[model samples]
Every structure is written in structure tokens, then in C-alpha cells.
Target: MSAALLPPSLSSIFSSSSSASNPYPLHCVSPPFNLAASRPARSFLLGATASYSDPSDLSLVSPTSDLTVQALDQKLLTLLRQRKTEDAWIAYTNSPHLPSPTCLSRLVSQLSFQNTRSALTRAQSIVTRLRHERQLHRLDANCLGLLAAAATKAGHTSYATSIVKSMLRSGYLPHVKAWSAVVSGLASSGDDGPVEALRLFKAVTRRVRKFNDLQIVSNSRPDTVAFNAALNACANLGDSEKFLQVFDEMPQYGVEPDALTYNVMIKLCCKTDRKDLLVFVLERILELGIPLCMTTLHSLVSAYVGFGDLKTAEKLVQAMREQRTDLCKILRESGSEDLVENDESVFKKLLPNLTKQSDNEPPLLPKVYAPNSRLYTTLMKGYMQAGRVSDTVKMLEAMRRQDDRSSHPDHVSYTTVVSALVKAGAMDRARQILAEMTRIGVPPNLMTYNILFKGYCMQLQIDQARELLKEMVDDAGIQPDVVSYNILIDGCILVDDSAGALAFFNEMRAKGIAPTKISYTTLMKAFALSGQPKLAHRVFDEMLNDPRVKADRIAWNMLVEGYCRLGLVEEAKKIIEKMKENGLYPDVATYGSLANGIALARRPGEALLLWNEVKERCRVDKEGGKSDSSIAPPLKPDEGLLDTLADICVRAAFFKKALEIVACMEEHGIPPNKTKFTRIYVEMHSRMFTSKHASQARQDRRIERKRAAEAFKFWLGLPNSYYGSEWRLEPIDGYDSDSL
Candidate 1:
């Protein structure tokens, strides 16, 4: 067909001008395959929709059928060469029979190269179709590996797993890149993804071993990259046992552990709380003569900083600064030796026992690495975490003064300083750092401005936050993302500006920025706190309608809080029931809000029921059947919730329940506000038994209430006395007797 007469989709395929810009150009010296000599060239377009015929069945292979199959195959190939993968997929699926394996493989390769969700889905479909047709063996190993990589890159790791399994079943040991991509993908994936990655690693090792035992010469054995990915998974999961098992197996495969391996092991140590083993990693690296990389150095410094041992972290950095090679010796001779002594057995079990070095052995650290911007930022983060704002500023200044260009601060380094100042409520200093970023040509990014927005919001400076957001757009030309709007919404909450919060939320949607779960919950919080429970409900409904955001436990709790804040106990209860229907049980915040609502509604019986549910989830001490700190429960209650419930019980004269709550608090290491309870007791129940009751049953109930009150007073270390008289309850000698 002529170019002007061709459809738009097919027109691009024949546009020879596009070949100049095509990144994946066809390097064929001739046409891909032979066409029939007598077939008329005019049949190319007309034969596209010709009657279907099975290419595998020779009886149906007429000249016209052959022409149609060849025409479709050639079209698919041309589309792939032009990088029109989507259109190529459409053409492939519309064909009556499978295209030639070469054309099919090219189509799969091109689609996989796109690495988009839709493209990967199509690639997976092709792989599945090939398997169904029993022609999977036709695809080359390189093409299969590309499909696996694409599936992994698109976050469909399970699909990648199936592709590898097919490759293995077909007697093709997958290439290293194929299985390694799957491993790395699962390792970085959250939740049980790391565990599955580790499992896949073991499966691959076993398969390789089986091949070896059968005398099948296979080069597809797990290599260093594969082992590192598995080890990283172990680190993420804090599975020290699996980490050691995998580390010990590396040598059997003739794979030497590299610096990245040791770095991952360092992460495992920090994650598993074996900070004492940090030095032993370095020791083992030295004994094995592994060349140290900058990442390993960064890991060592970060580990110490993570453990809050700033003195040791500083000493290590200072040693590197002075080019001293005695870091291990210095650490061993210093107070860290005591830490090692305390965890000696732990270190031995986690790592191989270090052999005593002979006198001829080289120094423990062969070379000292100077700190880079990343390493310096890590140490500065330690200062930030420790609340030493001045020291963090000093570290940034030190980075600027360093002569080594590698040590000069980057955007991350500057952001750390801003984060520190923001945390310390030093917004002015934070802005100064931002100005410096622009002055030095390291123009502030969205994250830098977001931090400023958060700082302003936290300080209830909404007008300032607004001005910053405007500057971030108009001056910096950076649009506000979901996080920026979420921060502003929360700022509106702080200033009790619910309408303002809604306006920002609407504006965010108007700009096509999807609100995350945080945005919805923050806006709900604004409405809840502003006493507009119905508006909060509307926001919650909108959040439910949003396909992108899922309603998590926090979102449900915010809805419940909205109703509970207005003393709408029944509505809150209904929401909680709905929350349970969604498979989310009430957490501490849910119960806390309910407790507040019950108090506001003066529903003491509801408080008692809520307490029953909470008590069941609270850990019980075996000693006195009280809640324990050592044993974690399914729902550990915070002090705010427990205190709120206890106050309700005290006000309603549920003295025995009040005593139980106070005991639970003490067992959990939370000191009860005895003075507050005592004050409530005096104010609400001062004349509890003064009135005489005509009915004997009523008098007996009064006696029980009086007895329980006296017991509660005794627990609070206050002397019980008749309240109708001038005498007042007095604190015992040991009690501080201060008001809460």
C-alpha cells in the first residue's frame, strides 16, 4: 500500500525516516527469511484478513495461505524493528496461527524491552501461549531472559518465577541475569517478598547441585550477584540463621565473597541487634584479603551510628581523616572491647571464629578510605538523631571546608542539615541552608521545599507554609506533589482550618495529583477536629471511591474518630463494626477515641464493655494476672487510652475496675496519675453513702460502692475517711501527692 493510503498504525512501520532515530536498528544484511518466489507482492495487504489456515498442517497450506502467514510474520517483525511494540502485539494476537519462532522471539524481546505494566502483561501472554503450543523451546535463552527481566522490573515477580521454572523444565538452565533479576526483585519487595527470594535462591542452588551430580556440565550455577541478592533478603528479614547458612555456602560454589557481601552482612548485624559483630566483619574481610570498597566503609560508619555509639563513629571517621591504618586496633583497645567481650559468644556464632594472625601477617586494614559525601551525611544523620543540631551544622560546614571534592556536600547532605534544624524548631536556620543550596547552584528540589513546608506546618505557621508552597511553584517551578499537599492539609489541621484543608485537597485533585492515604487521613483529621463529622464522612467516602488508595486501619480509625469526637457513640460503634467487616480490628487509637466518646456521652456501661475487649488483648502477667511489659500482647494499649478509660471508671464509681486499670498501668511501667483519680473521687463521690435508703437492697448496693471506693483510695495511698464530715482524704507518707 502507498504511504498516504495506509492506516495510521501501519503507516509508522513503513516510515523509513524513523530508522534514523531507532535505537534498536535491524542489522540484518538481508531480509530476515525467504518469501515464496512466485507470490505476488500485491497480496501483502489484501491477504492480512484471508481465511485462517494452520501453518503446522501441510494439507491446508495453499499458496494464498502461505502468502498470508508470511505477510503477517513480516508485518510483526517490521513493527518490532520500528519500536511499535503495542501495535506489534495487536498484530501478533490477531493472527490465525503462530508466527515463525524467530518473529515471535523478536516480538517478545521488543515488548519486554518496554518494561511497562501493559507490555509485560503482553510478554507474559506470549510466553504462556508459547508454552501452551509446546513451542517454548523455540525461544532462545536471551529472549527468555529479557522476558524475565521485564516481568521483574514491572513488579510482577511471581510471573518472572514462572518463566524461569519453564526454562528449567525445558532443560534450559536459566542465564544468571534472568534468575538474578528475580532474586533482586523479591529482595527489595516488602513483606514476605524477602523470604520468598531466599527460598528461590536455595531452590536454584539445589537444582544446580542436582545437575552437577548427574554430570551435566552447567554454567548456570548461582554466582556472586545471586548470593549477594539472597544475603540482602536475609538482611531485610533479619534472618541471621539464613544469612550465615548462605554465607557459608558461597565458598562451596567457588564464589568468593566480595565487598558488597560484607556490606550486606554489616546490615544484617545492625538489623539483628548484633552491633558487636560489626568489627568482626572487618576482621574477616582483612583475613580473607578482600579489597575494601567505599560502600563497605560507609556501611561500617552507618552501623555504629545506628547503634547510637557516636563517639566510636566519630573516632572511625577521624581515623580515616588522618589516614591512620590502626582503626581495628584502636577499636579493640578502646571501650568497644568491652562491648565485644559482652557479645563474644554471639559474634562467634554469627561469624567464623577469627584465627590468630601469625607475626608475618599484614596489617588488619591495608588501606584507609577517605570519607565521601554519603559517608559524611551518614555521620551528620547521627548528629541529627542525637538531637545535637549544632554538631550537625558543624559537620556540614566541615564538609564544605574539605579539600577533597568527593567530600563536598550534595543535596542529600544539605537536606540532612535542614531536617535537623526543622526537628529542632529552627526554621530560620533551615531556610538559610535552602538559600545556600540555591546560591551554590544546587537548586532546591521538591523534597527540600517539602521539608520547609512540614516545618512551617508544625509550627502552626500556615500563612508561611502557603507562601513557601507558592514559591516552590512560581519561583522554583516545582509543582507540589501529594506529600506537599498532605503536609499542608495537616498544617490546616494544626491551625483548625478545616475549610482550608479541603481547599488544598480539592486544588491537589484539580492539578491531577492523586491523594495518597496520608492525604485522605489528614483531611479527615481536619474535619474530625473541627467538629464537622459529616464532612469527614464525605471525605472518607471519597477515599473509598478512589481506586488508587486503599482504606487502611488508619483511615478507618480517622472515620471512627470523626463521629466519636462529636459524642456520636452509636455512629462510631457502627463504623467500628464496619471496620471489623473489612478485616480490621480496633487498635489502641480506635479504643482511645471510643473511650473519649463514652466519657463525653456519660455512658459508663459502654466504657465497661470497651474495657473488657481491651483487657482481653492486653498481655497478662503470670504473677498477678495483670498486664505485663515483658510479654507483648496482640493490642498493647498506650497510656492515653488506659488513662482515659480509668478516668471514666473513677467518675462512674466503678472503683474495682479503676483499681485494676491502675495496677495494669504500674505493671507496664506507666505511673498512674493517682492525684487525678483522688481528685475525681473527692469531687464526684464525696457524699456517696450519706443519704439513707428506705429499701434494704438499695442500702446494700450503697455499702458495696462505699467498700470499693475505700479500696481504690487505699491503692492510691490515700487514707479513707467519711466525706460528709470536714475530714478529707490524705496521702500517705510515701506518696508524692502532686496533681497530674
Candidate 2:
């Protein structure tokens, strides 16, 4: 991106141009004034060649002579050809002479060849100055095309398109080569520009067709390259039908399909699993006597493997090998015979350089196309997907045996096999493959260890997972990332080892590997399930205080569940309020947890209220197709959720709601336990008959509620207030009075 150096005299010339007011600095230099001024006017006239002027004349001329401009053009082209782009640009801009379109084209073409961002920017600026500032409307298509291509190569596809479209609107009718270049450039810019490339292709084609209608001869017709670029765009979008349609219309557009066109078509067919179309394409290739290139063979083999026709793929490989061997044998046999030794007279007539040859030097052999790592890996992936794991292993061995260096398996090649083995629950086999990878000098990467770590955790061998983590860090010298620590944390929680999980979490934070939301949620759930609600609350609070990590819905829900599990329903409701203040809302699991806890506490009315609120929120979120604030979106009710709600209703003595839940469960294709429902029903009737005991139970709950509320109020910064006098120290549920 280094800016080109310019001499002071040329700089002064460019300083006079109106473009000097432009904010952007130019990469090209201005021309010398003396070169333009000293050249005679007749030198630029008819039939007289212009001479390159000297820098000494850089300050001698005004910006008025055609002779001076022609001399500068000659000097600029010479400098450009010599790769002195900066000097050429200086001459182009400041020679007191306006450069011709030819000079502009060559200047841009040479600038693009520099292949640097600075060079491309200079080219773009030159085009802009010529088109607008200099009022050069009749600049040749070649110059504009080169500028567009330069922009494209710099990854400015949109700017390139605009340049091309602007040229078209100006009645320039850009050459087909320019259209093809722009379209292909856009199509190859990953997934971002394929649609635009196709759109441009269509526009060019329509314009070309209109020209034909009026019988006007124009080179604007989309050629094979243009259509092939559009076809490639179709392939990128995975539009198999569009690929076919484009291919079919090639003949109508008078664009003959070449090897590249067929290759892209074959790739499309294979990707879409259109085996029949592949066969037809192959037949056409043979009919046209077009020799298949390496890409063609690779595509065909990949297609067959994808089609589960391994036998045909193997035949193709075998045929290729035989062809190579036969070619080698013929070459060796032909090299063994020397015409000079057999006929001395013919040798005398031979060229002197060919008459003598060294026997030590072997004859050159033809290069054979061989499978590389990418091709082998593609086949291996196909085998893995087809459940032919053994075939995948054999293919790896075959790749290792190839004579070409590229056939050697890299990290991806070995990892793919291990990953497949891991997926099959064959951890031991996967380990063996990993060992082989190391033995062959292909060092296993962090991804390899992570895969193995996941496998061990999936098998519930947390101890082994810990060992693998240490091995990855200490032996491999690769630092474990957040994912590695998260896996271990989850494993510890899965086995009910909350203390171990907490230790890992702390270690993760101490290492400066920030704990993600999942990390916090996992520990919170473990603490809650282990009946350590206090520790769970501490985790939630710590998560809130950490500025780096934001507490998501899952983290909030886990905290609420921890409080609810301890029968501290009031604390749980406070969490819901806090979440609302933070523009968050509880999800279904939050309500389910609250319902279970409330029902266990014998508070049916409160449980029903939570359930109805959850149901209504889920409905609103579903109907509106949007969520308010940071509220979590509604989740569809599963069988487990319905069962939890039904149990809560039964425990709350809401018989009608309990029956409704049962009906809803059945509607969702989950059969309710009729026997359990009947037993609950009977219990409800018996409880109804014991009116005195039920009254006493309600009175006891009222007293407990009053005590808990006064304690909460006293704790809310009113210890000396009159309302605090009613707050007597008393245990509510299983917690101590102070614990509230």
C-alpha cells in the first residue's frame, strides 16, 4: 500500500488540477511540465512521432499543447511498461497535456498488475478523474473494463458492478469480456454476490438479445464465459433446476459449453443427488469427444460415492491407475531404443545437439493425475456418511500410499475418521486412530482433543475427561478454551458432584477464560438440585456482578428454581420482579418450578395463578410473532410440562383444573395415569369431609405468611419502623427466620 513517489515539478502540475481539491491522495504521480512545454506542436500533429520529454522541461509549459500531451503519453506508457507506475501517473496527470484513452487504458492495466490495494485505489481515482473531472466521455471500453476489474480484485464487487452498469447507461455497451469478468468476480466472492452476478448476467443477455432483434451487430451478447458464470451462481445457490435451465439455453444463445461449463454442471448434479442428470452429462461429454480433466474425474467419483455406488468409483480409480501405468511403460520402452546406434548414417544427418546424449539421465516421464488430500477426504466423508466406517479407514491408508506428496493426510483427514468413530461410541477405536495420527507425524490439534473430551463426557467417565483435559493442556501445550472447561463443568454436575463443578468453574474464572451463560446455568442447576439453594443464589449474584457476562433467561430461571425448591416462594416471586425490571421475563420452566414448589407448600391458589400467567404469556408471544423487552420467547408445552402442571393442580386441590390438565395432556397425545387421578380425586373428597382440620391448616398458613411478610419488610431497611414491631423471629417452612 506504499504510495508512489513523484518528483516536485510533476507534483506542482497536479497541484493545479481541480482534482487536487479532492480529499483522497493519489497513488499515481503528476507529469513533468518541461516535457510537455519543450515538445514542438508539430511533433503531435499528423504523421509525426512524439518523443518522451526530459524532467528538466517539467516547469516550462502551460496546459494547452496537443504535442505536449502526446509526448507525455509516450513517456507515460514507457514508464508504465518499465513498471514505474508512479512516474507514469505523474506524467498522466500533470504534463500540461490531457492523456488519450489509449494511454489511460494502459496506465490502468499496469496499475492493476501491481495487485496492491494502493494500486487499485489509484486506478479507480484515475478513472473517476477521466470520466468526471476531465470530461472524457469517449474513453474506450478496455480502459473502463480494466478499472472495473481492478475494483473487483480489490474485493469491491459492488463498485465494480456500478462501474459496469454506469458504462452501459452511458451507451458504451461494454465488451462481453468486461461483463464476464465482473460476473465471475462477484460469483466467486463467497455467498455474498452470487445473486448480483446472476442479475448482471441477465441484464447483459437481454441487452444483447435486443441488439439481435434490430439486426444490429454488437459484441454485447453473453458468451460462454458469461453464461458459465451465471451457471456457477446457480450452483452456489443450490438451484439444480436453474442450473439445467441455464445449460439448456446455452445453445439458443449461441454460446458453446466448454470443459469448465461441464465441470460446474457435474458438480451441481452431484451436489443435488441428481445421478440421472450426471449420466446424461457424461454421455454428452463423450459424444463431443471432450477429454475429461482431473476435476471432471473428481466430480464423477464424488457423485458415485454419494450415490452409494462405491464399486463404480473404485473402477474409475482403477482405470486411471492402469492408464498411467500403460503410459509409463510405453514411454520407457520407446526411450530404450536409440536410432543412432541402429543406423550410423541417420545419426550423421541428425542435429549435432541431439547426436550425443548422456546415458545417466533418464527420459522424462509424463505426469499422472493422482488423488490429493481433498479428493481422498471427500471419499472418506462419503463412506462415513454411508455407514461404511471400514471403507473410510482403507481410503485413508490408500491416500498415505500415494506417490504424490499432496496425498498425505493432514489434520482434517485424520480428525474426520476419529470424529466418525467417536460418533459411533467407539472411543477406544477413535483413540487408536489418534495414536496412528501422531505416529505418522500428523500432530493432533486442539479440535482432536476436544472431540475426545466430548466422547469421554458422553460416556459418563468424568475422571477420564479430567485426564484428557490435563493431557491436552500439559502434553499438547494447547490452552483449553471456554468450551473445554464448560464440558467438564457440565460433566461434574451430571454426576451430582456440585463441589467439583464449583471448583472447575472457579478455576475457569481464575484462568481469565470468562464463564459463558451456560457455565453459570450449569453450576446453578447443580447447586439447586443438591439442595444448596444458598450457594445457587450466590452463583446467580456473582454472575450479575460480572460485567463481562450477561445473565440470560436460563440463568435467571435456575436461580428462581433454586429459591422455589427451598419453599421460599416469596423470594422466587421477587426474582421474577427483578427480571421484569431488567426487561426480562420468566419462561415455561420458571413457572413450572414455581408451581411445583407452591403445590408442595399447599398453596393451590398461588400455583394456579402462576400457571395461568404462563399459559397466557405463551399464547401472546406465539400470536404476536414478537417478544417485548428481553422477555424470553414462549416454548411449546411438552409432555413433561403438562404432567408437572397436572400434578400441581392435584396437590392444590383444584379438582376442576386438575381434570382440565388431564384433558389437555390427552389432547397432546400423552395418556394420563387414570389410576393416580382417581386416587387424588378420592383424597380430595376425604379432605373435603374433614372441615375442621382443613380450617386449622388454612389458619396456620395465614400465620406463616404474615410472619414471612413482616420479616421481609423489616429486612427491607425498616428495622426501627412501627411495622417492624409485628415481625417476630419465627422459622417459616424449613428455613430459619433470618434466612428469609
Worst 10 residues of 1 by lDDT: 41-50
- Model 2 segments more than 4 A misplaced: 1-74, 77-83, 90-102, 128-138, 212-218, 306-312, 322-740
RMSD of 2: 20.9
Candidate 1 to truth, TM: 0.75
lDDT (0 to 1) per candidate:
0.75, 0.64
The residue ranges of model 1 lying beyond 4 angstroms of the native Cα positions read 1-66, 82-105, 115-176, 189-193, 199-221, 342-346, 353-362, 466-486, 497-556, 570-586, 619-635, 713-740
lDDT of 2 at 65: 69
Q: lDDT tens digits, residues 1-740, model 2? A: 01132223323322332122222222212110111223332211001011323222233335566776667678877887788888887776566645666777788777766766656656655554443333445356666777667667655565667777766655566677777888998888654578878888877776666663633535667778888898888877777667766767788777787777877777676566555444445444544556656676677778777777666566556655555523222322333432234334211221122233332232222345666686677778778877878888888888888887887888888987887787788999998988887787898998888888878877888898888788778877888876887888878877877767776766665464556667778878878887777778777776664433457878888888888887888888898889878877676677777776776576767766765765665566567745564545655556666677777666555544555566566655788765665565455533343345457668665454344333432433323232625544545356443311
- Listed in order, each prediction's TM-score against the native is 0.75, 0.45
- After TM-score superposition, what is the CA distance of residue 224 in candidate 1 from its true location, in Å? 2.2
Task: State model 2's lDDT.
Answer: 0.64
Cα lDDT of candidate 1 equals: 0.75
Q: 138-208, model 1: which lDDT tens digit per residue?
A: 67766777887886876556556656665665556777778888999989886567987987777777778
Cα lDDT for residue 136, candidate 1: 56
